[model samples]
Target chain A: MPRETSRDNMLREKHGKEIDDIISRYPVRRSALLPLLYLAQREQGYVTEAAMKEIAQILKLTPPQVYETITFYTMLNLKPVGKFHIQVCKSLMCALVGSDQLVGWFHAKLGIKPGETTPDKLFTLSVVECLGACGTGPMMQINDDYYERLTEQKVDQILSDLKKTGACPLKSGPFMWPEARSAK
Target chain B: MPKHELILLKNMMTPGYTGSLKDYEKTGGYQALKKVVGKVQPADVTQLVMKSGLRGRGGAGFPTGVKWNFLPKDYKGPKYLCCNADESEPGTFKDRQLMERDPHQVLEGIAIAAYAIGAESSYIYIRGEFVLGAHILDKAVAEAQQAGYLGKNVLGSGANIQIYVHRGAGAYICGEETALLESLEGKRGLPRVKPPFPATSGLYGKPTVVNNVETLANLPHIVNRGPEWFAAIGSAPKSTGTRIFCVSGHVKNPGNYEVPMGITLRELIFEHAGGMRSDKKLKAIIPGGASAPFLTEQHLDVKLDFESVAQAGSMLGSGGVTVMEEGTSMVWAALRLMEFFFHESCGKCSPCREGSSWLTQTVRRILAKRGRMEDIETLKQLCQNIAGRTICAFGDAEVAPIMSTLQYWRHEYEELIREAEAHREKELPMAAARH
Candidate 1:
C-alpha cells in the first residue's frame, strides 16, 4: 500500500512500455518530445541527459529536439519541482484582479519568487499568464486542479491540507460549481 | 444595395463574380481596370487611393493610400500586394463569409491593387484552415487569367498581373503583417520588429503592402464610385465608410452586421444582435475579438467606432462583438481564453511563451479548489509583466480577458474566497473533491 515503494519498482520496469505508447501516439515520432520528457520526469523526478537520450532513442529524435520542445514550453519542468507546484496567473487580466497579491502571498508563506522552488521542497511558486478564468479574478493552480475565487484564508487552508495529506481536495461545496454560479 | 458604388465593395455579391470570365464581364467587373490600365500610370492609382482615404482594415487602421504611397514609385523592386485572408480572430468570421459568398469581388480588388502598386504579381495569403475558400479563390484566379484580366495583356493594355493563392499553417501570429509575410516565405510564423513597417520592407525583404480581405474588397468600389463620392459614408467626418461588425456570443442573433461606423454598442447588441439570447441580462461584452478589453453593461451606449471604443478603454478590434450574459462567470471565461493563449503562444518571446503557460496552470489550480488568496494579485502582476513587453500583440491579446474581468468583477473573486472560507467552516475536508 506504500505509494513510492512498489510504484517506483513498477514505474522503473514499465517505463519502456509507457515510452512506446507515448511515442506511437504521434504521426511524426518527434512529436512525442513532450510526453517522453514528462515520462522521464515522472520516473526520475528530473530530465537527465541520459533519460533525454533514452527518450530520443525511443522517439527517433535528437536529444536537442526533445530539449528544444522541453525548453520551449514552460509546463514541462526540466528540473525537479516541489510536491506542490503553485503557479499564479500573471497576465494583464489576472494582474487587474490582483495576481500580484497572490505572488506576494506565496512569497510570504512559502518564501520563494516566481520561478524558484522552496528550500523545504514542499512548494514551488511560479507566476504565469492568463489561465482563462478572468471572471474568477486572482486565481492560481497547484498541479492539475484549479482553485477559483482565491483568498488568503483559503490559501492557508489549501497549504495546510496539502501539507497534511500531500494533495489538495477537489471543490465539493455548492458554490464551487460553475452552473450554480451561472444561475446567480 | 442601390447600385453599389466604387472602390471597395464594387463587385460585392454581384451576380456571378466567381471564377468565370463571362460572369465577371457580365457584371462589368474589369471595366475600371481597363479604364486605367494603359491610360493612367501606377502613381496616379496611388494618388486615387490617397485621395479616397482608404485605411488598412487588419486591425491597425493604417491609411491604405499612404501605405501604397510609401512604396518607391521608381524603385522597381519586387513589390507585392498580399491579401491577408488569415481570419483567425476568435469571434471574427466575416472574412470567411465574404470569401465563401463572393470570391470574385476580392479577386477584382486584388487585380486593381496589383496594377496600382505596379506589383507584377499578387498573392492572397490565406489561413490553411480555409480549404474551401482557397479552392474558390484558385478557381476564380484561373478564370480571371483566362479572361486576360490577369496574366498577359489585360484588356489590351499590355500590363501583366499574376494572382496566386498561398496557404498558411494555422497560427494566429501570422495575422500580424510581418509574421504573415514570414509564413508566406515558408518559415515559422513569428512577428518581426516593426519600424520599417511593411511598405519599406516585407515579403522577401522587398516592399509589400499587406491588405486585409475587407479592405481589398473595398477597392473595386473606390475605382467605380470615384474618390469624393466614396468618402462620404458612416459617422465621423474623418472616418469614412461603412464597416462590418461581427456580432456573436450571447446575442439572440449572432452574425456579421454591416453598419455605418457611428452606431452605438447598444444599437448593435440590441437592434442588430436582437439583444441577449434569453433576455437574462447582459453582464459584459467584448467589443472587439478576444484580445480587446471587456465593456460592462453600463458601457453599452458607447459608440462602436475605433476612436470611441479606445476612449472607453477597449478597442473596436476586428469588430467582433462577444456578449456574456449575467450568469456567465468571468473567471471561467478567462480560464478558457487563457487556455487558448497558452496553447497558441508560438514560443517566440520569453514573456508570452512562458507567461501564458504559467497563467494557465495558476488559473487551473484556483479553479480546482486548491487556490490561495494571493493568487489574484499574483495573476495581476504576472499579466503586467507580459503586456506591452512582448514582440507582438499576442501578449496584450492574451491579457484582455483576465484584466477586463477583474476590472468589472473583482468582488466575484472575493466572494469565491469568502465562500471557500465558509465551506471550510463545515468541517469537511476541502481537498478531496477534484472536479
Candidate 2:
C-alpha cells in the first residue's frame, strides 16, 4: 500500500470542513469533483497529484477519476504556475482586436513563450480562449482580475506595477463586480 | 420601437441598480416567484411562456414553452433545472452582462422556473472564466435564501427550491444541454446523443429543463407583464421578444445592445453600434457567434432574426455580431476561427476532432504561403463530410466559417496561391545563385 505524505495529511486536515460543506451542496458526492478540484487549486498553487488523490478520497472517487477530470479542464493546472498567471485572450473577437500583438508584447517583455513560466516564478504567460469579455477586447486575466482594452503602454505599465508591488494596479472593466455595481 | 423596450436588460441600464437583491426588489424582481408559488399552477406557467412565443436565445431558437412541456407529467422522481450560464461562444457576452449587472434577475428566474417545473433543486452551470459573475451569483443566491425566496418552503408555499452555482472548467461544449449534464455529473464535457434528451433524463436520470441565462431572465417580465405584451415586442411572430445583440469587433461602440427582434443588421451596426470603426469600408460580418457563417457587405440589409438570417445562409446564433473591415484577410479570418474550433473540438467524435485539425492545418498552410491550389476544394469536401456526421451541432458549427468564407471569397484563395507561387519562383533564382 502507498503511504500518505505529510503534505496530503496537512491538506486534508486544513480543508476537511470546507470540503464537507462543498460536498453537501450536491446529492451525489461525485458532483462536487469540479468544485473540490477548484478548491485544491486555490489551496495549492496548482492541482498536484497529492491534491488529486486527497480530493478523490474525500469525494469517495478513485484517484484516476479525479485525474481524468483534472486533465479535461483547461483551468485546472497540474504543474505549479507562477504567483500571478497572465492569461491573454486569443479567441476570435480578441484576436481581431490585436490579441496577437498583445501576446507578442508579453513574450518580448516577459522573455517567455505562451506556456512557459519565468525563471523568477513571478509570472507565467498563457494564451487562452474567449473569457466572455469580448466587448472589451485585447484582454488579459492576471490572477482573479482582468485587464482589458490593452495597449503596449498599458502592458508595460501593468508589468512594471506588478514587478514593483507584486500586484496588478489596473482595474477590470465595468462588468466586473464591486466596481460594476458602483459604476454608472 | 422608439427605444427598444428592454425586459431582461431593463435593470442593467438603470443607474444605481447595483444587482443587489434590495435594488432588484425595488424594481419588482421576486414578485413573479411570489405569484407563481401556490398561486399559479406549474402547467399554467408553461402555457404563459408558450403564449409569449419565447424561444431559446442560446443559438438553437428552440421553443422554450415546448421544451418545458416535454417533461413527464406526473413523474415521481426529482426534477432539475440547469441554467446554462456557460456562455463560452466565441463572440457572445450578453449573458455575462445580464449575470454581472443584474444577478438577482437571473436568480429570480431560476427560482420561478424551479417552482414552475416542480424542481426541488436547481444548478446554474456558469463558465469558470466568469470569476466576478460567479461571485455575484453566489452572493445573490445566499441573499435570496436569507430573504426566504430560494430555500425550503419558498415563500411559505410548501415548495422547496434550492439554487446552487456550478462552475465549468472552460469548455465550450458544456454549453450544449447533454454535455452540460455530463460535466455536471463530473465527467468530460462530451455531448450525448439525443432521443433521450435532457427534458426526459437529465442531471442524474431525472427530468430536467436546461435554459440559457437570457432565456430564464425573461420569466419575471413575462409573468408580470403577461405573455401578450412579451409576444407583441418583436416584429416576427416566430421569434418574439427583445434579443440582446452583442456587437463587437470593428464597431466604434462595441458592446451589448438589447434591441427588439428582426432589427436590420444595417441599423444594428450603423445606428446602435455607432457604425464601423475608423470609417473603414466593411468587408465581412459574422452575424452570430463564431459558429454562424460569415456574411458579406451585400448582407448588410439582412434582418437580425433567426429566420431571416437563416434565409441569408447564416444563423442568428447567440446574436453576436462581429464586423471586419476592408483590410482584414478572409483567409486569415477563416484560419483563426478554425484554430478556435480545432482547440475546442472535445474529441468525442472523430469527424469533428480529425476534420477540425485537418481544416486548421490546411488554412494555416494557406496563410503560411505553402498551400496548393486544390486545397480549397479539399477543405470544402472535408467540411461536407463533418457537418452532419457528429452527435452534436459542433460538427456543423466547425464547418460554417470555412464553408461560408469559401462561398464568398474563392477568388481570395486563388490570389493567395498565385502570390505564393510567384514568391516561390523568385526564391528559386536566389537558391540557384547560392548553389
Which candidate leads in DockQ? 2
Which digits, one per residue and each the tens of the lDDT, describe model 1 over residues B316-417? Answer: 877777787887777777877788688778888999999898888777766655556788898899899999998789999988888888888877766666
Best candidate (score: lDDT)? 2
Q: What's the distance in Å from true for residue B321, model 1?
A: 1.1
Q: Residue B120's C-alpha lDDT in candidate 2? A: 95
Q: Give lDDT tens digits, candidate 2, residues B322-428.
A: 99998899999998889889999899999999999999998887877766788988999999999999999999999999999999998888888777777775566
lDDT of 1: 0.71
- Model 2 segments more than 4 A misplaced: A1-6, A173-184, B423-435
Give the poorly placed runs of model 1, Cα more than 4 Å off: A1-184, B1-23, B421-435
Each model's iRMS: 13.2, 4.5
